[model samples]
Target: MKPKILDRAIVGASLLGILISTYALNVEMAIQAKPEYKAFCDIAEYLSCSKVLSSEFAKGFGLLPNESALKIPNCIYGIIFYCLCIFLSSFDKLNVIRALFGLALCTIPMCLYLAYLLAFVLHDFCVVCVSTYIINGVLTFLIYKKMKVLSAKKTC
Candidate 1:
């Protein structure tokens, strides 16, 4: 019994996330080609997308020993995560909404952790990264609302 408006909102947020992540990914690739490339989001020394994307944590995990493989940007994960959210939200079933709720619950912590890393460890914040965080927050709120509506439907 998820509201159609809520579903559309979720999809809209997910699409925004995907778009930002794709831009970040392109920036990442551009940086790889020309190490001196400065992203448009590189506002200041302490607020640079290139600095954050070039950092050690930009990869899957800080543990990978191979430098080349570590070049993979974390925005790839964002794209996948948001795409999954969009796919789940497209379904009208209550079970799908519940699944999206669970996914959102899991992503909230990861988003917080990434924010912490950006603020503390990296001492930098990418505009694209912050945008994705905001998108995630919106998606989480929409998913929670949809879940509540579904639960009330079940009870009544």
Candidate 2:
């Protein structure tokens, strides 16, 4: 695929990631304000987004200590990540594309850990969480493709 096309695809995926992460953040805040609130993504007992979002793991990626100062919600991190991706995708420099590809690649381990938590610990399916994971995967692939195309042009 062409680098320009791949960059556009990356932007598209980042936009989707932002939208879903924003929705998840809103849901998280709503749940905090009203404990009894029901999110639209809370489909069923086994597939409850609220259940997963409300868990302790949902905050700080469940990787930080309780007393840590950076205990922001995971959704916030997702929003920041997607936004950064959008910014990086706008650049045509090879180094910028490499950085973007590396950034997207780094999210995989976090996604795997969260997916494991959702399945084993939380025992619930979160629509927002799964959607973000898919978006990240897509973004990574698109960025990698773009990086390869750019590298090939320089080589030729």
Candidate 3:
């Protein structure tokens, strides 16, 4: 695909990620404020976004303890990541594109671990979580395409 097209796709995917993450953050806050609150994505017991979001693994990227200084909501991390991606996508430098590609690629392992938790530990499906994963995948692919296009340009 063309570099311009890939850039647009990356920006679009990153924007979507931002929106989803923001919504997830809002929902999380609402749930915290009122435990009885029902989110729009709370469809059923097993297929509930709230259930998954409220899970212990949803915080700190499931990597840090609640008391850890680095621990924060996963949605916040998503927001930061997508914003960085959008910022990085504005550059045409090969190194910048490579960095963006690397950043997007790094999300895959987190996605896999979250998927495992959703399926095995949490036993719940989160629409918002899954949507973010898909957005990450899209961003990764688009960034990769952009990297290849930039690399080709540099070689020529």
**For model 3, where is the 10-residue window of minimal lDDT?**
1-10
Error of 3 at 36 (Å): 0.4
Q: Which runs of model 1 end up more than 4 angstroms from their true locations?
A: 61-71
Query: Candidate 3's error at 5, in angstroms?
Result: 1.6
TM-score of each: 0.90, 0.97, 0.97
Q: Per-residue lDDT tens digits of candidate 2, residues 17-120?
A: 98999999999999999999999998999999998888999899988999998998998999999999989988888999899889989999999999999999
| Candidates' C-alpha lDDT | 0.83, 0.90, 0.89
lDDT of 1 by residue, 23-85 (tens): 988887898899999889999998898888777777773445655664466788888889898
Model 3 lDDT on a 0 to 1 scale: 0.89
Q: Identify the superior model by lDDT, candidate 1 or candidate 3.
A: 3
Query: Tens digits of per-residue lDDT for model 3 on 24-86?
Result: 999889989998889999988888988888778879978897789878889999999999998
Clashing pairs in 1: none
